[model samples]
Structures are given as C-alpha cells and as structure tokens.
Target: MSCGMFDESRDVIEYHPIPLWITPFFFAGSYMKKRIGKTSIAEHKKTLLPSDEVPNYFSQNNLFARLTYLVFWYLYVMLETPRIILYSLKKKPDLFYGYEVYGARVASIAGRILRKPVVTRFQGTPLKINEQRNWNTLYPHGVLGLKSKADAVIMANDGTHGDAILERLGAPKEKIFFWHNGIDINFVINTQHGEELEKRYDLNKKTVLLSVSKLVLWKRVDRAVWALSALKTDYGVNNAFLFVVGDGTERAYIESLAVKYDVSDSIHFAGAVPHEKLWTYFTLADIFVILQDVGNLSNQVFEALSFGLPIVSLDDGSTTGILKNQYNALLIKKQNIETDVPRALAMLIKNKKMREGLASRAKETFASSVCTWEERMEREQKLLNTLINNEHKTSY
Candidate 1:
C-alpha cells in the first residue's frame, strides 16, 4: 500500500526537496504504510501559505510578491489535493497519515472532518527554528494547533522539544512518542570498502575532518574552520584537511570566513551531494564535527558513526541524550570553546588509539542500539496505530 506522497518511480515518498525542512518523517510514514498494506494521504494546505514560509519576493519590485498565495500556490493545491483525497476516500484506505511539519495541520483537520484517524510527527521545538521573518509567519505558533487536534504526535528526538509542546502548546505528554532520529547503520558500516573511497576523494596522507550539515551560521561551520586553523598554527598539523558537504544561504559567508582565517586552501566545499554518494565522503573522513548550537542527533553525525568515525559535537539540543561524553562521542560544552573544543580536538588528534576506540564503540552502538529506517517506520506506525485505535479515549 502507498501512503502519503509516494513517488512510485523512486520507490519512496517525495519529502522536502529543498533544505527549508527535513522530510525523514514523511519517508518513515510511507515506508510503514507500504509494509502494512495500507495507504496514507498527503494533504496540502487548504489556503495559501502564510507569509512565514516564503517571506521574500522574486524581485523587490515584482507585483506578484504582494499577491496572496490563494492566487498562486493555493489554487494549484486546491485543484490537486481534493482529487487525490477523493480518489483515496472512494477506495477507503485502512489509515490516513499526514506527514511533514507545515502540512500536518491541514492533514489532521482533513482526517477529523473525514472521520479518519490522523497522526503527525513533531521533529523540533519552535525554539530550534531559524526565527527569520518568513519562518515566523509560516509556522507562527509552532504546530501546536494541529498537534492538539492530532490523534498522535511523534517526536523525532527527545527532551526540551517535547516539553515545549506539552507545557507550552498544551499537548498531552502521553500522546507524544519520542523516536530518535536515526540513520541506516548497515549502509554506513558496510559502505564500499575504504580503499576505493579514499582514492575517489584523493584523501592520500591527509587527515580528513568533515562537517556535513547545510552551511548555516547556527551550525557554526566557521567553528570547524577555526579549529582547523588552530590545528595548523598551534600544532603544526600539516596533514589535517577539512571537507564541508551540503549548501545553503550561508555558503558564501562560510567561504569568506575560511579565507579570512587563512585556511581556505585546506577546506573543500562539496555542495549538495545526494544521499547515495554521501557514504563515500564519510569513508574518507577520519573525524566528524557537528557544531550546531541547536538541535540534537543530526543526520550527519549518525552517518559518521556508521563508518566507525569518532564524532565531536556540542552537548546542546538532543546531542546530550543521544551521545555520551567520551563514550561513543566526544561531547564539548556549549560556548566553552576556550576551554573544551580545542582541548578535545587536540586530545583526539594526539591520541590515535583513543579516537579509534571511540569509533569502534560508535559502530557497535549503531549496529546494536540505534534504530534503522525499518525500525523507525515501525515506531512511527505504532504511534499512528495507537492513535487510530483509541481515538476517543483522550481529550484533544
């Protein structure tokens, strides 16, 4: 059975194509419904998007920038969504799950009005968002309104995000299920043998330090560059080099910082590589660094773990819960760079055995403890099924 927005040719659900959002949950929902022999529904907003999602216009003088989404995207969704929904309703799907952050509210409303069970996954706290003008209008009160109406809300990570939804948004804590944002362990551990990956990246005799998130200020890609600069200047680490994968609005700014720090020649910007090819980069790296000030359990960190590489990240967001200091990962305190990051990096670089030991533990953890794509789908399914099976037992 196909559910959500399944693209049959890709054999997967089309989630977020652009980086404005993360769509793993959408894929998770589709995979579950497909396995269960049920179909899921993908519903778009009934009205035009609030200015929050797309605050800027094509051109400062363009008249269309001031026009309502109703005149543009809304009309398109209005024309397409109903036909899709009606066709599925006529066939009577076993379950209807709405996925994604912005569109989940509309899906929940449709499910309620249609007398069908609905489940929505909440991945991050309102605090974790970029807080730019466009995002403010797009997700105003977070997804609290829709979550209140939803039968179940699945949280991708744990702690503060769930606390905000329950205490601030009034969502019942019991109705929210926390699923660790996971990676494909097998994909990482069993990637194309190490030698071929090294040759492809030309990583001969170079100690590769990799950062794999979108180049954004909050992510602090500059911090990695600063650390690399310190490595060269303070420790004479001539063999160390850094590879930054993924692109975003901050690309130019990051490049500028690298040049300013005089480490431009030591860094590589490999933009927006597809998922399949990511493992090759992972295999080439000796260490992975994630310096994002917010959010926990980044996808890049997990992919690094699959390759048995030691990970270094700030103990903020979900990072604290997902990783332990000096265990599977090396944890640095937030904003304690003067005291911790340099010390940690220096320690890891100086002690090859310790770094490799952490890598082995990380691999073992990914294989034995971390959830895979299939496990994540089942966990999401259980939450949705529980919501559907006992809809009236709890108040919204």
Candidate 2:
C-alpha cells in the first residue's frame, strides 16, 4: 500500500501534492493531530492509523526503561506488520512510498511479501550512518538489510548520504538519487517580521548572527556560541549578537556555554519560534551561521539563502554542493573550526561589500536551482511516477 509513518504534520506538507492513495501512521502528539486536521490530507485521504500507544512507565529515565521502551516499540511494529501486509495485499498498490525508517522497514517487508517495488526516502542522515562509523548498533544489520532490499532509495540531500548508502549500507549506486531540499522562496522573501524581531531583541545597531536549528549536539550550537565569543575577543567584533532560534535537549547546556564564555548578553535564545515566523529571523539577520557537522543539507541553509543572508558554515560534507567557498557562502575549514569560524564571521561582519556579494550570489544560486517547494514537488512527482509506471509495466 502507499503508506507513510508520520513523525509530524510537516512530513505531510512535502508529500501532500503527490496524487496517490496514502495512509499515514500518526505517531505524534495531540498538537500534531490538530496540525494534520487542518491539512487537505485529513479530508481527502483515507483514515490515518494511530501508532500503538505505549505505557507511561516507558518514559522513565533508566537503562531498563529505555530497553523496555524499545522492546514494546518493536512488539508494536511486529504486530502492525501483519495488518500492513494484509492491507497491501488487498490494495495491490503500485508501490510503497515510505517516509521515515519505521515506515520504510514496514513497506520493505510488505513489498518483499507481495513482490512489489518499494521506494524509500531518507529525509536525514539515516540513523548511525555517518562519517564516524559504517554501522549503527541501534539500527543493526537486519534494519539495514531491509533498507538495502528497496528497489530505489531517494535521499533528500546529496553529498555524503549517497556515499553512506552505497559504501556503508551496500545499496546499489544506481538505485540512489539525490533530490536537494527546496523552500518557499517567495514566502521567505515577502515575509516581513524584521522590524518587530529587531525591536524584540533590541537589535537596533547590532550585527545579528542567526542560527536556526534544533539545539542538538550534532548541530554544534555550543560551537556557534564559542564562535560568537571568539568574534569578540579575537576579532574585536563586540556589536555582533547571536539569535538562536529553536529548542531541544541541549538548550540548557548551550545556555551554560554562553554564560561560561561571558557572551550571554550577546547571545539571545529566542526559544522555539513558530515555523511561519522563522522568516522574520532570517530576514533580520546580518549573517547566517550553521555549525552542523552531520547531514549534508538543511532546510535552514536553503531558507537563509532564500532570504538573501550571507552564510558562514563549516566545509563539511553537508555543505558539499550547496555551499561554494567564497561564492554563495564562506565555508570554513572544519579542521580549524575553532579558529576559522571566528575568522569567517569577523570577515563577514566587518566587510559589508563581501557580505552583500556572498548574499547576492547565494540568492542567485537558490533562485536558479533550489527555489520553491513546487520545483521540489515536481521532481519528486517525476521520480514517483517513473517508479510506479515501471512497477506496472513489470507486473503486466
């Protein structure tokens, strides 16, 4: 069946336009349910299946609790797989389009049983598949084996992820296709929250450095704070202020880092702004900084480019195609991030001409290549249509 495991309503936003019979498995909270209800998917599509609810005891913070949670979750998956297989047999779908890992696993198994093609899309770096290691203990060989069985594997971003799939997971190279993430360019450009955001943060005369992402270790938000501190001490850039937008587990640790660096006053933690309001922060920023070491591309990078903000990022695999050194963005050498990041930030902060040059090129690059959601949707549709048509042909 054409199925997906819904992590959030945002997942629907990407795949919504595809003209296919879709049944989403909602594993989100009540707020996400409300969000999904507002979408056209809720009205047009078949009823969404609710994921098996686990007990509150699973929430306990201990090894036993964690293992118990995994055990229960695996049991739920095992129980659900039969239902999915039965549904697939009844529907005889052209192909299965799996969104997340769990969905992909279910679809892979179902596809194998029914002798149907499975197209799985990896939105982010697949769990435990990165430069650091070839294998993830959490994912295990069985999960990877199931993933490798897919007829086609579509990655949301290019670069390192494709390599990870082929080299690490032993997936066939021909099955891999890279579709760079896109954003609503006009929406970001026309969005007008600059004045209000500036006033809210008292960013009247200060040069604002914006980082919009989840507060996580992989994101290296602490490094961003350290860069800000260096921008002051090393480069003598005191007027520069950082506005961190988004919240996660590392928020407290990041806050402590800011305080430790004595740049707490300069760093404004505008925790978890609404997605719609993100454009304002993007528009108001003097420079966009992403210290993410993992994942090839981010929606924030595209959004920042769309908003015409100059970017300074580490020259890691994630920024491979999207960021060009001294072109669209200033990519610092990852080896010397502690020194190079501050240098890049200082260079952009001090030189308006350079910033404008990079910003102009960045916008031009985005406009020509990854501009809007429509363009991305069209590409995805083409890929999906090809897969479905091929499946039909093979069946006939």
lDDT (C-alpha, whole model) for all candidates: 0.60, 0.65
Q: What are the clashing pairs of model 1?
A: 3-40, 4-40, 52-134, 52-137, 52-138, 296-318
lDDT of 1 by residue, 286-313 (tens): 8888766566466766677778889888
The candidate maximizing lDDT is 2
RMSD (CA, Å), each prediction? 11.0, 10.7
Which whole-number lDDT from 0 to 100 does residue 128 have in model 2? 38
Candidate 2 has its poorest 10 consecutive residues by lDDT at 49-58
